[model samples]
Target: MLRKVLECRRCGYRTVCGRDDLVARLRIVGQLRRDKDPDESIVEALLAEYTPLMTCPGCKEVGLKANDADDEWDDDGDWQAAVLCEICRQPIDPERLEFLPETKRCTECQHKSETGTLPDEDPEFCSRCGALVELRVSRGSGITRYKRFCTGGCRGV
Candidate 1:
């Protein structure tokens, strides 16, 4: 099914809307402008009603462009790169993706998740030494409560 979606140009965030929903929203905004306040302009009413939908959920930026897209081929048909495992940050298997396109985890991660053996957090590696980085609580009164440190003790290198 083809549907209309509002996409943020800056952050690539998409908000899907059906034709009936869009029409209903426009009607509501028009009624609000007519019944509630005649002084309120149509542009003001539209912006007030659609500012949240126009704003990118990921980056909180405005300016959304409308586009018609198929449900299966959304995001410009770049399904392989678009779908990634939430746990391992790897591309999900194409077969599994075809079967369940909305899945967030890959097969291994999904199995581990279902078995309650999935790790709480993925291990971060140090850029300098390629060793595991550990999250440590800060002692001083800083903005961030926790900071990542290299386990191999590569101090500020």
Candidate 2:
């Protein structure tokens, strides 16, 4: 387990590891959390409560979600802006950020439309640039046609 800290700039939420033998201990807990024991229920309950993060109690109260990173600003020396993709909710590829700078979809999710599958968003041209728009569809009796590419463009990137 590599050491990493996840701090939310939105609500001061912070999850720090290796603060106490974190790596070595986390390795063992993975298996035990799967055991069919009563404690396993507790583990699931706690994890469900926190979801992606453990907790700082106060931070959860403010509802400073990971999505809030869209308006993200650095809160401190170590904390940086959120880089999670709006579509897949995963870390946007650092390389994509290098190229597009404002990419909100992970590469896989972004390419879904390219593969002829429409994403959940409405079809329209990219708001920033009138690039080749993602394909949106309308189903028919025996075929599908382009309703439009969902709204918005390449994010001016």
Candidate 3:
């Protein structure tokens, strides 16, 4: 069975886990805390307590500089599972992966296949900064449209 695992982007450190392991951790957390905030979820509490303790083992071994001001060691970003689309071979958006972990295609590819449309092949450049532009696809009222914007926040300029 496929299971989600956290991998450090820089150091290639990985923490393998399964549903059983998560259930055990959740049980332990439940036992440790009796009075939790009504609004705070058990998973949030578990993450809050566990995030501080997570340090990349590979980063520690290689002596990489910690990004945090506190003694906690970490890279610029949090360790997360890097999910790539089977069609595009690009990193799938984290929000999309969070909702649909089994997705094989990215938003653009998925929309193209569903609507029988192809994305523009020619590269677009930003007018203000001359950087490569990215295409954003939007669908509304049974219509699909593509919008181009600069990657370097030059659209406002």
Candidate 4:
């Protein structure tokens, strides 16, 4: 069995690992144990919580978690933005989509539409975000159709 021991970096006081070991010990003993003093019978409960950080790790004095990097200030560090294809729900890198015009099929949707079947003449709307998708048709010797997404998000209300 692995034992957990917690030691404070600043203070000399040491504490036993509380979560993993305490949960395991509780399973072994039929009765619950009071986290407080013997006569107090008080149980101290700990749960997962969200803590927002506002500083950069490379330069800021405060520490940061993996996800905290996104919350960092724009001037201090890079901003992580979420980009999703208007047609497909799949994630897209913001960098790649930067140059793509507002009126182009996402790489995946484009490939699928080209290989399987041409999209219908009518404009389509994003099923998920409810954004209006515009399909442009060119009247060549034959019918040529192109697709584009609405500038505003479909769900805009």
Candidate 5:
């Protein structure tokens, strides 16, 4: 299973795709490797020909390049270099990023969002962390409805 990314030469749009997934419908399934067989040339060509059609609606090949997507990220402390918190615009600390690299909030903001008491008024997501918002609505006897977050479970960290 080779995980890769395809970059569009026209617009530079990138998308993650697996080699197996890309070649599944290409009619070449018996070329990867067997018990102790050596690498095959057909498999290599199929992987190299992975096009940008996986993400687009139609076929397009302006020069689809295959790159190891997994190689883009590592736990080598570089991803934590510097990023702005989407909530309070605070600089993220590299030390804290070791665990929560995708966090969009600082420690304090994350805590507030978890407790469901974020300071921002009527925040759709976490006011401090900018988490996903789960919208909820209830129906009454006849016709009673007003857009609102039903409860604290509406937002997730």
Candidate 6:
């Protein structure tokens, strides 16, 4: 039977058995060709290879992978995945790319958010004291309720 093969044009790699083939071939290639140790995580190896794949052509620094919906691929090969900025090790959801790289008002602006910040908020910087407004919450044990607070010197002011 002729199966619909998924081909990665940038690397000239083809897959017919979905993620399984990609995972298996990556493991073998890593071990034999790359001479990577067997103790290494295969999934991590696969991810490393996948990052440079065609998704962001010539831009290996930023990459995305499609996460499995209900533990499987979507009908159109579209699903949400963890977005990784390889240069900064900052991860965000692929679906919600609120701040892409190389933007003037991007959250990456040091005047705003620091490195390793999740791409959620724009990060408020206190104009009065030049301090960033950060909120920290701690959860312990089982079944904890949600609470909110304003961090830094912004409390009760």
lDDT of 5 by residue, 31-146 (tens): 22221332345545666664432333234434566677665544445442245455654566877787887777888888888899887633344433434344445667667665
* TM-score for each model: 0.29, 0.31, 0.27, 0.25, 0.29, 0.20
lDDT of 3 by residue, 1-157 (tens): 2233545557776554333333333333232232232222444455445533444446743222212122222253664445555455456798998899888778988888788785553455566775667877865766789877788786732
Candidate 2 yields a Cα-based lDDT of 0.45
Top-TM-score structure, candidate number: 2
Q: Tell me the tens digit of each residue's lDDT in model 2 across 1-30.
A: 222344555577654332122222222323
Clashes of each: 0, 10, 0, 2, 0, 0
Candidate 3, run of 10 with poorest lDDT: 62-71
Winner of 3 and 6 under lDDT? 3
Ranking by TM-score: 2, 5, 1, 3, 4, 6
Highest-lDDT candidate? 1
Model 4, 54-128: lDDT tens digits are 122134332222221121334544533334444553446565677764533567677777787655534444555
Candidate 6 or 2, higher lDDT: 2
Choose 2 or 3, whichever is better by lDDT.
Answer: 3
Q: Which parts of model 1 have CA positions greater than 4 angstroms off?
A: 1-82, 121-157
lDDT of each: 0.59, 0.45, 0.51, 0.38, 0.52, 0.40
Q: For candidate 6, lDDT tens digit of each residue in 6-63?
A: 4444454433333433343443333223333433355455555653442332333333
How large is the C-alpha RMSD of every model relative to the true structure? 16.0, 18.0, 19.0, 21.8, 14.6, 17.9
lDDT of 6 at 41: 52
Error of 2 at 110 (Å): 1.1
